[model samples]
Target: MLLDEASIRRESEHVEDHIKRWMTVEGHFRILTALSTQMTQDAISVAKTSPLVSELYGRLLTGSALLQLAQSPIDRVQCSLDHSGTAGTLLADVWPGPCVRGRVEHAQSTQAPLYGGDGNIHVSRQPARGGELYQSVSPMHASSVAGALQHFTMESEQVITFISLATVVDDDGQVTMSGGLFVQALPGMTDEDLSKIKGCLAQAEFEDLVVAGDHPFDASAAIFNDVDWIETGTDPILYRCRCSKQAAVGAVRTLSSDELAAVRAGATETVTCEFCGTDYIVSAVDLDAS
Candidate 1:
């Protein structure tokens, strides 16, 4: 039961009001916060069941949603983090609906620390079923998820992208709250407009906004002051695992009987879903019959 929910909403009246307040204005731009209960559920399940592997991947997934949202002008983006030091690879696929699905490779049940000194972070854009796919590669920074993304945007895209992420770990060291925000300077946007947006974001203080769980989070983007209130969209992001018993069965079907026997002979005949840390047991007898 993985959750994959996404929504998109806008603030027309708010934007209008802001436009009236600020003399300097530009075209409409969006501000988005993707706080996903499904993400929390999935992360917690993976962390609790497999502490060592789920934490980093969970944050990467949550952060990917924010990155996708930042690219409102772009249709789709794929973010992948490869940490060669300690933590494994993390992949996130994001689309216009701001919908996201992600997974961690080589997960385990114990908590292990990861260092991100010399790893690679990749961001790419691949539109619906037709358009060409474009990608950029950047190096990870200080081993922080948000920091890595900041580097990617600043270095690769030449766009000033600001981001902040926070994930609450319960007493058992499992993820409870996984959410973040991403703000970027839109293309063709005037320097004045960009400066104003940057000033406002600095005033809001991304870390404070994200870490302050008690306060009501606000995505009030005050950019276009001259335009009328047009419309609003919602993108309620969620956690969803693309793993299924049938898929597992299909995968198993590919293995020869001897290979199956070899796998069964190895203790713990379990097939762990790398995406969500859900394990499927395949008894030796079952494998023999199949």
Candidate 2:
């Protein structure tokens, strides 16, 4: 039941379409969700451990990664959860175009404090490399998936009024579904308008809605029942890897001349992408050409 490239593209389009439809103001806010039982199963299969641990990792990774994309114009994002399941790191990039990158790491525990103190969700945002257009972090006391994201929006430099995020991993570890909703107030929005929107979002019960609906759009519609919104555009998102044989050869070229000679004397060198587990082989002739 593994998803092929075509299937992955289809799912990506579905999620992107929903997000685009939920947009109200241009670049002011964004809502995105992704659901993939096959991808979840594939991710957990790599662990080969307890179902509980695998499920937890898959859920957190999916939720946090989606939230990261909601905050910036990042086209690619990667997240790595700690072995203990209490901490993780997120890396985001725009890749090939402008090449902006940022990283955020967080740990939560009473004894080992990474950010501020115990039970304090201390998150940090590294400065963007290419431009200063995107740089912000939200640190709050709540640690749940929804709470962390809400804090992220509230603490961002953007004028975000409300955000709701929810994720559910099936009990049997067979399915993973995640939904995120973002609401931002444009310039000149009055305090009264912000307050009303916040009140509506507070009463939305987005978590329950996500669990009940079969799709991200359904969940979003339920969350913002009274808001007037329309479909704008779409962008596809998939668990894709930016790795290839040429990239592998370039990597080998980075080694010292002596190392390259040694590699030439041996078998072909194979490089594996850590993100998507794709392997690329570089032959001796390829290295010689470089």
Candidate 3:
């Protein structure tokens, strides 16, 4: 599939969460990355997470955005950490498109070990126009959230792939730098070619590059110096929660008519978004209508 420039997550001021996508000139591989900042801080803040939880949250956000390349811009991809660990279940339910939101089942318990020790990375995708859902799961036994995501993609695609994720937090527990790298071997690429690309990337100090002066995309040239590269385009990834009073009312409408009447008699009901913890008040007028 062609990586159309029009699909770049742009035309918005919320450009803090952004990524750059590229492919080898010989079409041997696909790569995506960025040294993200505000987006990470803003996104993890949605859950008021602890330092331990922040790093994993950052990786999920970055991994999810980079993974969007596997589908069209109009499609949707959701990544969730399904585990019974101390952190409970964490979800990065978004792409670089319209809404990039996340949820923490238990904010206070989000400090559990990555993947809760026996969890799996669950991925789901569907057409924006509405169609059958495509889902996949891979064991999350790796050392990092990035590893788990990479494991899922490689196993799901049954292809050679490389993924690296970095999250740096300061003494104050602030997200200093957040980023991810995804490299997938495309058809026709020789084993030697893939080896060369991997070698060059392996030698590059990924964590350092993530905080280097230049944008990770521009700085990537130093790592791929021996190989020619082509740019598909760049797009922003912002943390945007899709919630509102109207949505709350619609949710309330899902109840039985009798239940709705009982709720309306209360005059108002509070709807708190599990994703962002934003509260919306549903008035009797809203429930009484229609």
Clashes of each: 13, 0, 1
State which candidate has the highest lDDT.
Answer: 3
| CA deviation > 4 Å runs, candidate 3 | 1-15, 96-98, 109-116, 211-215, 288-290
**Best-to-worst ranking by TM-score:** 3, 2, 1
User: In angstroms, how far off is 224's CA in candidate 3?
Assistant: 1.6
* lDDT (10s digit) by residue, model 2, range 1-290: 78788667757644442233255443334445444334344444543324444434444444444454554434333322222223344333333221222222331222222222223233333333433343333344454544554555566545564445544556564445654555556666666656656676677666667667545556566656666666654433333335677888999888888878878887677787654456887778888775
lDDT per residue for candidate 1 within 30-140, as digits (tens), equals: 445455545655555654435434545656776777676655335567788887645567678766555566655555534345636678888888775658888888778
- Clash list (residue pairs), candidate 3: 17-237
lDDT of the candidates, in the order given: 0.58, 0.49, 0.73
Comparing 2 with 3 on lDDT, the higher-scoring candidate is 3
Relative to the unseen true structure, what is the C-alpha lDDT of residue 133 in candidate 3, on a scale of 0 to 100?
Answer: 93
lDDT of 1 at 283: 58
The lowest-lDDT stretch of 10 consecutive residues in candidate 2 is: 107-116
Task: Give the candidate number with the greatest TM-score.
Answer: 3
Off by over 4 Å in 1: 1-25, 49-58, 69-78, 84-88, 93-113, 124-136, 174-176, 214-216, 219-231, 253-272, 279-290
